[model samples]
Target: MSAPKPSKRPIRSYVIRSGRLTDSQRRALDEHWQDYVIDYEPSALDWNALYPQQQPLTVEIGFGMGDSLLAMASAQSDCNFLGIEVHRPGVGKLMHGAHQAELTNLKLMCHDAVEVLEHCFEKESIDRVLVFFPDPWHKKRHHKRRIIQPAFVSLISSKLKTGACLHLATDWQPYAEHMLEVLEQEPTLINHCGPGKFWDEPERPATKFEQRGKRLGHGVWDLLFRKE
Candidate 1:
């Protein structure tokens, strides 16, 4: 699972490219990805109507390359998966992984996750939310771009079912602390893991990037929060 670091990364146009959606993902999910998913915009998505079995749904946002998403879905087949990501290439890669795993109880959306939460889904519709290794936004000017801001946390909280879980992970210690601070302000969420939680790594497969991070002597953190 080792790959040479991608070389000569190009500055991509911020414009969304419709061509990036892979055919396999389309064939797998029966989803036709839109060029630009609107923010806080709702689409007609009904869980009960879509799947008669109506299994509990787990939503993962910013799944960098979807390595963990594929692994978790493989291990937990009984639960349905809903993935939201802003990057097109990553979404395309996730589609490939979902297809390769033959995952049926999975769906994907390429839109501002907040919009998905506000518009398409109903209250208590989601059972779990996972945000892993989001952009650190190290630069002071770009701090607003960090995903764990208080406002964003409030929106995410609105989408969860009672007793649902919200899990977050970051390799950056600063952002990890930021996540805890912002989440603490939200009265709706209660920290389920103790002070020892930040020190422990959850049981998960070694991703290509995580393995590399470990080789470089970096520590990864996991935070598991529950809805009160």
Candidate 2:
């Protein structure tokens, strides 16, 4: 008899860290989840049913601790926001904040962003996509695990509406260069700051992590690309 074949493990951009949840975070997850969280399903989401009013959609991937996302949602009442994160504590914190603020324009999903984008969102459905400080995967061998690859960028481009924007920020220069290269290679996306250049102005409010990085003397690179 032939030996059993080994099952292939999928390459993931992030490893699930065992971050302990505080009491409030746990309680928020248990109590307010249904109010602000969207369970992931392998089907396109009906935005009209999800939000009370029809508005432009902005999706933020990997919103660590959700501080920046919450700020944006609070500030941009005209736009609807969907945040994707795998961390339970972050999701809970965001939900807790959303509930306290009575934010009707925000929702969240706890799932792998790549799968969510592929399955739950329709093509040309997103008005804006934000990817801020994703895991750098700094090791050379782990570069393949970085989310800013050609295929991923192409997928993002397809999901964006015509003239819609993709904003990416990274503290790692190497990863920033990699992102710029990958995004530039996508034929459907045009760099909003011109070719081979980064955004000079701060387009969004700084996240807690970003502020901490800045305090540590880290330089940030921002890239803005639009779907053609």
Give candidate 2's error at residue 205 in angstroms.
0.8
User: What lDDT does candidate 2 reach at residue 139?
Assistant: 92
Model 2 regions lying over 4 Å from their true place: 1-7
The window of 10 residues in a row where model 2 has the poorest summed lDDT is 202-211
lDDT of 1 by residue, 133-178 (tens): 7778788777767768887788788788999989887777888888
TM-score winner: 2
lDDT (10s digit) by residue, model 2, range 24-110: 899999999898889999999887689987999999999999999999999999999999999898998898899999999999999
* Candidate that scores best on lDDT: 2
Error of 2 at 207 (Å): 1.2
Candidate 1 similarity to native, TM-score: 0.78
Worst 10 residues of 1 by lDDT: 32-41
